[model samples]
Target: MRTSLNLKKVSIALLVVGCIVVIIIAWLNSNRYLPFQGAETTSSGSLKAVEKRLAKLKQAGEKPTLEQLADAFQPLGLIDAHNHNASSSRYLSMLDVWEEYHIDKVVLFGDISEPSAIGTDAAAWKAYQSSPDQFLPFFSGFDLHDEGSLDVIRDNLEKGYFGLGEIAGASTYSPIVSLAYWKASDPMDGFLPEIYDLIATYKAPILLHIDPPNGLPILKLEQALEAHPNTTFIFAHMNAYNSPEEIDRLLGIYPNLYADFFAGFSVYNPDGGGHPEIFIPIMKKYPDRFILSSDSGYGIESEEQAIDAMYRILYLLDDPALAKKIAHDNMMAIIQAQPATMTQLSAIQELASKNGKAYNYDNLSKLEAGKILADAEKG
Candidate 1:
């Protein structure tokens, strides 16, 4: 009887051990598969003890409402490419912040190089993953210019990042900030090729805010094109850094070269040449190549402005086909390029409807614009 008892005990111990091994393997696999949901790290590299607090928030289930989102005139689907709420304190948790605008998706990125800005960014990453319906995250950890940046980029790509972004001040124009930023760092070193190579390998696009004197437009862009011939590059707010002539030249030269026109703050400056007329010729000339971005989501002031402006610009184009492509076709092409689920296809179809007939460029009708915005909000 004693021998029988010992055998039974041993069997139980073995079963427990096997279960533990399986659990450990599962945990390790989860970490590898889910970097966004890993233990949150601070911008300065310290891990915070938010386990209990997060649990409380999760259990309480405070579902942030649309009304909690600040009021905005435009629908949320009207996305702007790069927005940090003008660097405001309220910028944190902006994924929910934009709900009122009815924005279907926004590209959210964080500075991997910030000394004190990492923790919140990790939370933002988790939030997007938890409810991808609410946010389409553009993962960013660090710049290739800095140390360990390549690993960060590669790991993000492996984890299913939308693309790389917000590489500050490397554009074609010479903004004062871009100038100061470049002066502080050396971007042209060996890092450039490695960054471009990884970006190419991932088949991801690079988001940039480059200006001329601060960064080389023609030469640097050419090198990037040569290295990552397959990577689709989307230059946001093609300010002075990327001149009209160069946009035409590079986009013409490389099928992968592209740009978005959302930097409304600068592109729509009173003294600046507006995005539409200045670039519509190119947009029309290369309809399949470019996208129309709001460059928005900062705050009350910029809401709907980019879309409103797009209306005027397309109206100016006076070509039904050109206007339709910018308003819906090009963006649809990008989304459709990927293999989306039936649900994703349906959602995009509705969004494309909104973009297509929302406004007739030649007619200049605010009522038509209001109807589209209203429909999206209802959606």
Candidate 2:
């Protein structure tokens, strides 16, 4: 009888122990997958530890590559607010890279002068048609003095262009470089009233590449902002690498002025090993106004590398929510605010169907006459 009782006790103990083991395993699995939840304490500790390590690295004169910096944090998806579709070949390759890196959306712009070049307005529209869900196409501003400029802008808008930009301002125009040829007419120039009116009327966003000398553009921009409160204006390259305090000041005053981080400024100094101390407080102060982008041009090997660079810089902020807002959410909110119409959708579909293959633009010369002609003939 004693032996029988001891055996029953042993069986009960085994069952209890087994139940405990299962519970522990389940808890670990849940924590492993959902690290963001109930892991705030751990996450904060990790961030501090990383900061310390980065400081040490900076002191030792060791700079980490973007990929190395990115690997230290959990992978988060991104939305690029400012990017160019350089060429049909480059853009198609970038799409593959974007997919690999979990980049959900990209705001693509084209050059007005080179409409048929792989990186011009035509390429952006084609890419958008190919992947309507992935691209937000913005038409480049033409010579404001030209009579045909307004007509071109209106035509693109009617054909489903999301916005207007990469408009050149005094800062971006340079006589020395062949590429920096497009110059914005002086802000006092008479042509802006009609352009601003059209943008406001259509409820479209305008991205301006302004880097004023002696704050000349700021006054002009302020006037434009005050005049067209309904239109959203994105300052390219953080107003030509302005100080964070200036960014804060501008953002505080103008609700419509949004800035994108694209230039290689000291604030984004990758060699510093982490996010700049000055930028963090400013970003926190105006979390919604700042957006992250890879203004990497045609020379980049892949879009994934560019995104990884963005992620690396973003992770340095150490605030996941703020990171999310800058990396993806802010841009998404802007795009969602101006939803695409049925006409736009139908047009995109038609273009996609007509293009057939997305990445066939290996040679620029052949694309205009051969591929486009063949597609048209078939139609």
Candidate 3:
């Protein structure tokens, strides 16, 4: 009886050990397939790996293909904080590219200037009507000097315009035309007390395009930032010509100031290499304050090209989480924080219908699908 009991205990122990061995093997297999977990995915080693791959191609006297480069980094989804819909062709093309690249949302800026009425709020309104979920429309033409201009902005905001700007102080266009031609306005002169009040009251974020490097523009921006503490200001193109240190200083001074990475001289070098070394540190230091934007519109060759440029900039950042935040989270947070009223939505729909642009999502999707398939076959 004792011998039988001992044998039974040994059998049970063997079964448990067998099960443990099976579990160990299964865990090892699962980990082999899931290589993207933990340090392996986020480390600088990943960037180095990409560099090594490129180097190998170069050594072989071969150019690195887009597919190979794309393979080097993980896929990213984006929310473009600044973009233009200059024409119907551009707008529709952008939508297709956005779909292909996994860009879920974009802030569409309208040209209130008469010179290019193609990208006006009406155009954006038409786009919004087509894909309400995909695009957020901002009304431009904020002129404090002209009461009629102010009225136009107010009416549009009341009619469900998402926000105001790409409004410039240093630019050549005037909010109000004194004569038939568009007049240039000084940044200091253009940004008025009433304009701040108007934006603050509406609770809309303003995307101001004031190029820095000039002292007066920076000073004027500071004045505006100081005066309108409650107003959310997005300084476009990473303040254009400002260095990272200057941007850091400005950010430290103004808690309300946010910057968009929208293809500035400092951000991208004329050489094939992007200015990741400059931007990565600044981005890490001010993760929440910085957001990604294509700023692609009439002039850009293709949305794919714009997206690829953005990705090149993004891959330079060592932190994947930080990259994700800049690409999508930061913009989404800003949008979600500012919810439009029911009245605004209703007005937007009415305005969109009045604009009379038919949005054919199915047709666009089908067209894009064909293009994607063709590209895949070529690859």
Candidate 4:
């Protein structure tokens, strides 16, 4: 009778162990902590809660394997500066990547931010909640008109947004987008400076979208750089080069400035592709300053195929490793560069003193999408 009892007790213990292992496996495989909250499978779901859970999972050892992350995600470190699920031909999300390309993480910056300004920016950001894992989010165009802009930004930052807009500030134009810039303050009223002040208050970096014959969009950009040297600036669609000489000129002066080629060629010459002769050499010369952007969401072939296209630089460059850095590594480091920030005053100190006071950043209004950019180039 004693022997029989021992066998029954052993069976119960074995069953309990099996159940525990199974639960752990399931948790690790599917980041299913809060019942997969925030991932609505549709675009309209609420994700703020899910974002919190994910942070905890990473802290806990329940994170997914790198290969698991890569199953749909390519290169372990790739963050596309330009991507969207709404307002474009393709609508790729994190799940789609997991199902198709195995993309682990994707940084999402809503092409636009303030909804009151035609809401194009907000709509772009709202669409990406469908897949959060692959997307590290950045806030886009904040409406200075609304006093709530800065507060809303702080709330979102507390929620875990990575950076600010692909700051294609004033004068960014595209066929799909009509506005060359956001509804910036009236250049004459000194509203532009006020907006920057708001950004400084929150302590976020702004991505600038204008490239120019004058080197950068406004003389004020350099001033902004100098005065707020601590703020990191990203110049997207780097087609500002009216010629090779312009490229050399811009890079020569702005050591703090960072550039990317994703939109540089795609929007300008769809039929032929990017002008590597000009952009490639520049990227090679400053590999540390460039970042990769598929520019399109995973939903469209153009978006999905963007990574492969950028990756092709490996064959084109004299040093494949550096080419890979420009295409993939540089951005990864930037994304990881979350230097400790405690007091707001300390954050402001980081801005480089590039003579922001000299620039005449008076009354420039940010235009609505497709409104100003219809003829304006992405550079």
Candidate 5:
């Protein structure tokens, strides 16, 4: 009878411990949703780290060819404009590839559909804090269906995010899709129109992914483009599944709509998207409309291969000035046009004071201010 009682006592203790463990995990998951959570360093430190990398590159004979530089004295190289979840271990481990290819900047964002994927905006923010110069972080960490999503977008923008996406709007047909479900339904339906207005208010670009590129999606896209003339929408993958003539038509019609031409998808991907050369004429026709990307650096095989495919497209351009425009200038122009707002700078100053770091608030870029504000907020 005594032994039986002891066993009962042991079971109760085990149950109590298990409950505590579960509670701790729940707390951690909730905290992960917060902006800039898990950031390990400060914005100043991040800037210094990138500066050192730049110095090393210069020592290694790397050259800055493009006229537009995101950071002064930094060289202009290929900018991978649509790298999703860039903080993923696989992508982070490939920094050497960025150096080898002379890639100067990458647009970083994360999958925002939670409980299904790495769905926190903090992932991109953390990555940016580590290497602010190498990455331009965009926020898409809110569920489209959530009523609070509008507030989340506005909050992040006010906190100084450079841009708004790589937002997975409608992915009806794609073998490479990471999530089992789409986070957003129709690109123009529900909260997106309001989100576009918020983006326009900040003059920030929103990168959108709508697959199959035809039917009702195209009509809806046109409607959204017409409705939000002030907002800039980057059609992800340059509608890889559609024809170049379609791309030309879209560009000719919508000055507000831009194209994210994923070189990796064009050259590789057995999904039967035509050769990269097929779009060369259209690219030449509308050079400013196109921005190059690696799309999680899939290139069907590896990030390195995807980057190589990008270079191939650059080589085909032949004209250095035109190549420079597509390579980095176009994207930089969109970002630089919007400086850090007075509100953002004020918040940054307050954060800097809180963190015991003295910074010239007047000179901080949106990315820099965002990093500082994020670190302080995390604390």
Candidate 6:
């Protein structure tokens, strides 16, 4: 009878151990802790939550398959803090990619340096008109070094621009982004500081790209940050040419600076060595400082893959709140409800009065003021 009792106790203990192991595996696989809070399912309904898809890729030691990417990003939504080719035919072709990836908003502009690629403010305004909710149209339609570019900036801001940039500040290596016409010698040279302050007065963010992310350009970037503390300078691609440690050091020092964490570079750019995980610690250290971007759907054949790589970067953060912040919250906090300053408003009102539509302008939103000025100019 004692022997029988021992057998029964062993069976019960084994059953309990089996149950515990099963629970542990399930917990590891569950999508509950994913930063993007939603049960986003593919058409098959079998693949739910981007976290699951990312995990499968991690386990298999494989690159992202099209099937593995999310059909639609979750409600939390990604705010693409940096992108180019806005207000152009190429931009229209990429819209479906935005919907599929759940890019809730994009900081949209066109090439400011490349003569063949520069898009006009009118085209940006027209694109914003088509989907004002999804596009944050930044003014980047002119040469940064030109004295006349200030008038263009002032006019567009009065017309309701969200901000300024993807401005080609410094570059020497990129064949695609030739700066023959308008590259700044550094971030602060010539009229760039004045431009920085002008944007600051409107509380606008400017995304500036400076390649070979070390030496003189970085020093000049620091100087600009110090000189215009109010201006939000988004260092493009997290200064893709620098190390994570260097990025961390800069973020520690500059409250006025932020970074567009270009995910494609982190994973695929030969410069960054195919390691998105290397940035995980620094990104976590400065959670609010980093914002995700794809650098104009660069290099990757399918934008789906680009976006999938971004989610993989998010997964490395390992904290839901931190992931959400980098994904969208950080950028949203910067761009949401950026009101036109009283000076900008007064300027627009003056222009309107000259055009014979004098009305009280104290409460006009930036968009409202911009539309009024745009119509007056057109009329």
lDDT, candidates in the order shown? 0.49, 0.61, 0.60, 0.47, 0.71, 0.71
RMSD of 2: 12.2
- Between candidates 1 and 3, name the one with more favorable TM-score: 3
* Cα lDDT tens digits for candidate 2, 1-379: 9999999999999999999999999887555422111122235555555566555545666566654444443333467788876457768777666765666677887563333322487777777666665677787746665667778777777566777867764453433212444456444344665777776665677777765523676788778788778778888767344677788878898999888875234334443233455576887888898888777532344445556657655756766667767776676666545534334444444666777634222222211222233344346
What shift in Å separates residue 234 of candidate 3 from its native position after superposition?
1.1
Over 4 Å off, model 4? 1-76, 86-104, 111-133, 145-148, 176-182, 185-203, 211-216, 240-244, 263-274, 297-301, 339-379
Among residues 3 or more apart in sequence or in different chains, the pairs in candidate 5 whose N, CA or C atoms overlap within 3 Å are none
- Clash pairs (backbone) in predicted model 6: 159-370
Model 3 earns a TM-score of 0.66
Residue 341 Cα positional deviation in candidate 6, in Å, after optimal superposition: 5.4
Residue-by-residue lDDT tens digits, candidate 3, 1-379: 9999999999999999999999999887555422112222334565456556545645776544444434544343457778876456768866666765666667886564344532477777667666656676776654545656667766776656667767664542222322212222444464355666776776677776664335776787788789889888888776354577888898889988898876433334342134546767878888899887777722345555556656656656745567667766676555544434444444334544866643322212211222222233344
Judge candidate 3 at residue 222 and give its lDDT: 87
- Better model by TM-score, 1 or 5? 5
Best by TM-score: 6
Q: Lowest lDDT 10-mer window, candidate 2?
A: 360-369
For 92-211, candidate 1 gives per-residue lDDT tens digits of 445443554444445555442243224434544554454444333454445445757787776655444546665652532333334333221323443656776676654566665555
Of the pair 4 and 6, which is ahead by TM-score? Answer: 6
lDDT of 5 by residue, 1-379 (tens): 9999999999999999999999999988665423321221124554454456445545666443322122322233568898875556855776876766678788887664443333446677677766666678787666667668788877877766677776766767755443524356667866888888877988889888787698877888899999999999999887477788999999999999899988887877775364678888998999888999888765478776677667667756655456667887788767665657677788766766777776665445565566566556556
Per-residue lDDT of candidate 4, residues 1-379 (tens digit): 9999999999999999999999999876555221211111212122233233334534666534433333312333345556544333334434465345433345555455345323434444444343334455566656645566666656544334456665445453433333534444222112435546545544445565563425334466667666655556676556434444665565677775677556324433453245555466776777788776666522225554555544443324434345446645665555544422232222222221332222111211111111112112221
List of clashing residue pairs for candidate 2 = 86-119, 87-118
Worst 10 residues of 1 by lDDT: 38-47
Give the range of the ten consecutive residues with the poorest summed lDDT in model 5. 33-42
* Candidate 5: RMSD to truth: 19.9
Q: Which ten residues in a row have the lowest lDDT in candidate 4?
A: 363-372
lDDT of 4 at 66: 33
Global local distance difference test of model 4: 0.47
